[model samples]
Target: MEESGNAIGFLENKTILITGSTGFLAKILLEKILRIQPNVKKLYLLLRATDETTAMQRFCNEVMGKDLFKVLKKKWGANLDRFISEKVSVVSSDISVSDMGLEDSTLVEEIKHNVQIIINLAATTKFNERYDVALGTNTLGAKHVVNFAKQCPNFKLLVHVSTAYISGEKEGFILETPHKLGESLNGTEGLNIEIEQKIIEQRLKQLKANGASEKDVTIAMKDLGIQRANQHGWPNTYVFTKAMGEMLINDLKHNLPLIIIRPTIVTSTYKEPFSGWIEGMRTIDNFIVGYAKGKLTFIPCDTNSIIDMIPADMVVNTIIATMMMHKLQPPYQTTIYHIGSSTRNPIKPGDLLRFTCQYFIKKPWFNGDGNAIKVKEITTFNNFASFHRYITIRYLIFLKVLELVNKASCNCLEDKYNDLKRKLNWVMRQVQLYRPYLFFNARKPKLSFRVILAKSLDLMTPT
Candidate 1:
């Protein structure tokens, strides 16, 4: 096949292996590629499953059946089945395991021979994921993918999808470069990964030795992950482990064509594969849904803080364009691409708040009683102390009154009120946990904010 300036022409005959095909980003990538370039040789979708049958089921239900692929479905019509059979294949594998947990030698050999591009998109995005799980999937799992790439004779590019937050609780400009673990940022030394990993292992062993229940072990591990993250200067386990994954790739990418795409808070599609298409609730979407339902009243945030967000379809486009650039322009070295909008077209928390209110005004939501839950202007706080004070003075005192009433009423409503009290306390704890990001004032000289420089994709940088 002759490669041309046209992206579809360039991608015509190359086989691609994509991990995390069931994920949000990967599904969008897959749909865009199939919809635009049906002539591409094949797509190996690696997903975690017990067998190929189960993997196919997941691909059909979770990926193809999703609203993201509706445009493609309309185009293919009666030929959709034939098109999918010719273009897509599912491999039952887990990124967290060695050799991608592939048991079949024949299938492994097939991948080794035909796969030219490997996209590592599988990762644990849970902010408080268990330490062992995060380490194995994000850190060690990445190492395994690199090893697999080393064996592929035709491998050309490995595009690792990462997050911009991997810069990790730092202020000022974050360069498009791989940062080493324990490397000083602003005169502060980064976390010692080796020592931290050992600490986590020891804590788990101690918990097991104490005959802790499974639930207790899980909770202990989650808490330990967060503690280690904060102790080492990072905000959470998700970003810390993701940063480690990047470091692993950096060490192993010697002489290989690798590009790391660090995208900021990914939102719905802006243009392609239909507009405003999004899956289940993302980070900020949680607040939107809760607020719309009138479940969340007060939130803690600095209105002026810049929150970098990029549309999912834009990320998919950038990924494809970057891959094609690398293919067309050979001898390319490892590069980091920060695909975000802050540096180009900044969007603030205040802007999002305004948009949400405006949207709901045009399209109001109603409660179960069939009454429009006319949303009031959401109250915001500048700091955790102030937010905590408000919660304590208003909600906590009210709960205390309920407790007293229950005590006076022969414990009549005590059980129900106690449950509500516990839930309120949990919400307060979550608010406290997330206060740093919410109330972040990037303008403060001492405060840290991520600055992603998007120099890689000069072709379509946001205006």
Candidate 2:
């Protein structure tokens, strides 16, 4: 199939507000819009002010500093940076704030006068974040954006970035669907959002009163988010709060023309803007690293379980293409689009493991051992316990006798066993710390955000 440009004149001369402009998906989307729809009037980036002069510095250091925009730099030369700086202005903002962290009259007027579109991607993508931060960044942040969108004079589309795993506590065909979350999430969909905010404030105040370090406070908040997720039936704070955000967006953005693009497990770019432009790897990369380390031996996963893997580039292309179609067809607004690879392309975890093994044999980036981690499939029962039992009875016990000789001889296999035990203990502890959401089930609250996905699919037939 021929790859066609997804963005048309849809963005021409239009002022767009893009949140999460520094993130993986946002990077691709921003680059595509800039490169494809270069004439888009102004691009307002809403990012938190890390320090003084935050917006421009963040735009340069965060967004344009990466390798993803290298092509844009080379092609446009000096004009590219200038274009981004001039046409693309930054607003030091926070999604957790009442007005998306943009309270300045000038910036507010800039948005009301010039901005025509709002794309909210700013979020705490950390799966194990604090409940308040997750809620603030994910749920309430969207609310702030919606509220801001309501204030815009000539607002067009308010695109929300939601995850595909919003439907918690249920599992099945996992259709392109949604959930009616009235109170199940927080013991009473009526579980006052205001109360939670107040509690967060109180907790933070206590932290400050105790003179807690910023790092300590952050850690405590993350632990709280994880604890909250456990209290609820979801995986972790990220998806849980994202679920709440989806529900709130559905409830709050009633009058606004909005579409939620729910993409699943965004990976490296498969094409466009730049192919395979990946940096820090997270979910899939961990799998690759484990396979390379020869440690992820026995995985307990549903092999037929259809792992939905969509390339970030494809997702971005689909997102832009959807916007174009939506511009042409207005009713496509207020829908949730699952830009997941569940439709056509599917590569399972086992498949990924095998591929990593093969790839590593060819080009190895191994650990400090100087010896590559050997990859071999061990039986399910043979992970650590049963194998340990057999080895303990047969080999470890024998080695115990030999250890006396080995201490006499140094470098004994018995000593190796002890070292391995210590290492495995450490690994298990780290894994447990991150394991609040190994098995998660949440449904889409509604396709209210999916109109863009349908429109894009109709335009490009990606699946």
Candidate 3:
């Protein structure tokens, strides 16, 4: 983990349970744990599956089989299977359900007695996911994990991986301290978790009873999440529900050894476990891909605004360090740390765009016609109206003409125009969902990261 050299030793004989093995952050964390401390008593990966066989399959196909673990695979060689079988085990469990939804009593007992560390990484990262799914997995899921943690008699620490955006719309100086109970980081009154859950459930039940179609249900729930999020002072459903998840942990911690590490816009690995390794398109990666492909010419953003991001490996290192530091300490209160780079080494949107364009110029992507697409300077609009106008003129106008042509031609174009219109509508939805984050220009001057880390890490911040 590239810590101060003792995290691995500290985890020597510990049994650890980690949720969210399928996620990018958890994948890197698992690889690092196995690569660094092979002697760990047992590292259980709690995945969503029907049985252990399916869980193992997912563990192999999604986690260990990825390129991130190539080095470890080569190191273990012929004994790779044996080592993994002995040191790593996958337990099919969904945190959204009660008691982590573990049906196997044998496995439950195994974890209750042997598991000393619990790292909950399971979360729905979709910024515009359905409210029901988001609330179920992000909010109630934390409650279920907390309940399970209480059952773990030997639990040394419960590390809940959260997002730094839990601060919501705060302008500057987002602190690393745990947000106050019953309030958002921005000082907005927080929702009662139990009450909110009941409200969502009742609303969903009413929708179903009213004979709402699935499509209507999805749209209604999406709008509800956004409306609630805006009313609650958060940016979107992802951050809003994650904040509730953190709140649930806060209410339920009850003197347990807990460390909540909130990382910002997690990207690829910086150095360890293979540099520059990343799985799916993360928060900012989508923007990079769309821009490089020339599909996204306009973005609503303040180019000079600082975009905080941290390498995945750095986050993993910090997680390990936090766990190790807390393992030997007394059972204390909850602690939160914001793991990000903006306050220390800020990367502005303009800088990111420039780097992205330059990288594409050096190693451009080829289009379907077998020619490298020439990268263009990104155009940033100050507001959504300007962005919408640009998109309408640049893309929608042509589609509109095609629609007229298709109509005049009596549908001779075979729904091509209709398909394009559908795609454009979908793109518009995504843009709307991402508008606030991309277009934000905080009034608060800046946040001091170095000092926050110094305070949060107990003066042992990673180098």
TM-scores for all predictions:
0.89, 0.81, 0.89
Whole-model lDDT, model 2: 0.68
Residue 442 displacement (Å), model 2? 9.5
Off by over 4 Å in 3: 1-5, 184-190, 327-330, 392-402, 409-427, 441-463
The candidate scoring highest on lDDT is: 3
Overlapping backbone residue pairs in candidate 3 total 0
By lDDT, the better pick of 2 and 3 is: 3
Q: Is candidate 1 or candidate 3 better by lDDT?
A: 3
The lDDT, on a scale of 0 to 1, for candidate 1 is 0.78
Backbone clashes in model 3, listed as residue pairs: none
Q: What tens digits encode model 1's per-residue C-alpha lDDT throughout 198-263?
A: 988799889989999999999998898887777666688888788888888888877779988888
Segments in model 1 whose C-alpha atoms lie over 4 Å from true places: 1-3, 181-198, 327-332, 367-371, 411-423, 441-463
Q: Model 3: per-residue lDDT, tens digit, 213-331?
A: 99989988888888778877787999989988888888887878898888888888888766799878788888888777776666788888888888888788788777766644556
